[model samples]
Target: AVFLTAFMPDCDGPRTRVIEEVPVSDWMDSVVDEEHAPPSVFLGPEFVRRKLYQLTSEEDYTLCQSLARVSSYYVADQQQRPPFSAARYGAVTKVYVIAKQDLAMVEEYQRQMIAGIPVAEVREMADADHMAMLSAPEELAGHLADIANNYT
Candidate 1:
């Protein structure tokens, strides 16, 4: 699947706030230092709602791990990388499905990304969070199915 839910790289919007704040200790726990080895960043349970999966159900939130580690170097690299060029995927249909209730990236930033990139189509998940697959599974799945049917 395409990168449907995550914040886009080139949107000069409020999502930049999240990127600017990510390397800080309060938001990320650097478990593996790149100075010694490959760098890794972990997000605690408390950070899930505010940063990753806002509006997630209590049960799923609890099921979520307090520490989920990912490569800090990779994340840092992504922040510096340029946005994907639409010309590279000549005939591919690019659809952006926005999660309106996502607090991590915010709705305004989502719209800004779409406007900046010029997607083939835009769809909204009114009540969905960043983790829409868990927060609003059926609706997300329906959208996915529709995309597959129409785009593919």
Candidate 2:
């Protein structure tokens, strides 16, 4: 599996193990639902573009303006998920593709994740942002194809 600027969990740790705290300001005009064990926030356009789709085109950015969904952060149902054991899911060949321009997760944090999860290989797309498939779709696809051809 290729992780493209995503939430990468260590095989032996929680999903939030390497995640940095997102500041309240970063959430912008979030409409929050406190019904869950922890409140879920719906990201506004400003936050989404700034953090996730910074390098994407106007059309791509516009698509999110209407269809953005609530964030699963701090949700109650998923908090109980256990880590991936070394003998199970972790045994798969993992290839992490780092989006260097990603503002949401950032490259340093991405490297930190690879450090924890023993990946078969690590690739980097220097121009891509967090939403790499949108920002750099062709490059991302090429990388994925390469990984599948060689690694899988």
Candidate 3:
């Protein structure tokens, strides 16, 4: 058996448009306080170049392609909605480890999303933001270990 932890992708969605549209600096200011503002207001060209390079790297391209395909499918599925359906994947169990901060954005799907799925667990990492792995690695690792022990 394998245990997996959920994480938010580095992309903005309709529900996060307000924070996404704001200058990155403004958003950071509110979240981290002006006194500790980030070095740059927005993602500089250098950062973008590095990210593009990383995304296109041989080791990551496969994941990039898979994400692109999934994104396209999600959009198309949304446009032709009947009732919500789960994505078809071979995993024996799927646990959606949602961050407390991201709950607002995904709340709408809470009722319809897990209708027939066997969600082995739905753990919330309290006091953690979207990037919990980076912000709270120890806590995240503990949770993952616990999940692994229980599942395996």
Candidate 4:
């Protein structure tokens, strides 16, 4: 399993949600409706460019902008759910890919998750952002290929 600058949870008890270390002002550009049940979040273009696709080319970000959608970040469902079984989830070896320029999750928070959930290997890309597939596809693919070759 590979976690590419993604939130990783342990196979233990409750699944702790990743709290955004960024300030409210940082997300002010994005649309967030707290009044809605469970809340709705729409990652605006400017916010996405700065936070998610900072390392990507402007052309690329613009090209993919139309595909973006409004979504909700509800961890309550995950929190209420039971943890994954060690016999299943923990049985698999996990590899984590750290994206240094990821403003969304940030590098420090990524390291913390890795520390919490032990992984077989850890890889990092200094040039990658939150969307490493877009920002650093070649590097991300290289890491994935290496992981697959070694792990599988």
lDDT tens digits by residue: candidate 2, 48-84: 8888888899888898787888776663444467766
**All candidates: TM-score:** 0.72, 0.85, 0.39, 0.85
lDDT of each: 0.66, 0.78, 0.40, 0.82
RMSD of 4: 2.3
Winner of 1 and 2 under TM-score: 2
- Give candidate 3 misplaced runs (Cα > 4 Å): 1-91, 103-112
* Each candidate: RMSD: 4.4, 2.4, 12.9, 2.3
Give the per-residue lDDT of model 4 (tens digit) for 113-135. Answer: 89977699999999999989988
- Across 1-152, the per-residue lDDT of candidate 1 in tens digits comes to 35566655443434343355434554642253446445555565566767667678777776776445464545545555554454554235578888888766678867766666646788889988889898889999999898889877
Q: What lDDT does candidate 1 reach at residue 59?
A: 73
RMSD of 3: 12.9
What clash pairs does model 3 have? none
- 100 Cα displacement, candidate 4 (Å): 1.0
Ranking of candidates on lDDT, top first:
4, 2, 1, 3
Q: In candidate 2, which residue ranges exceed 4 Å CA deviation?
A: 19-26, 37-39
Clashes of 4: 0
Off by more than 4 A, model 4: 19-26, 34-39
TM-score of 4: 0.85
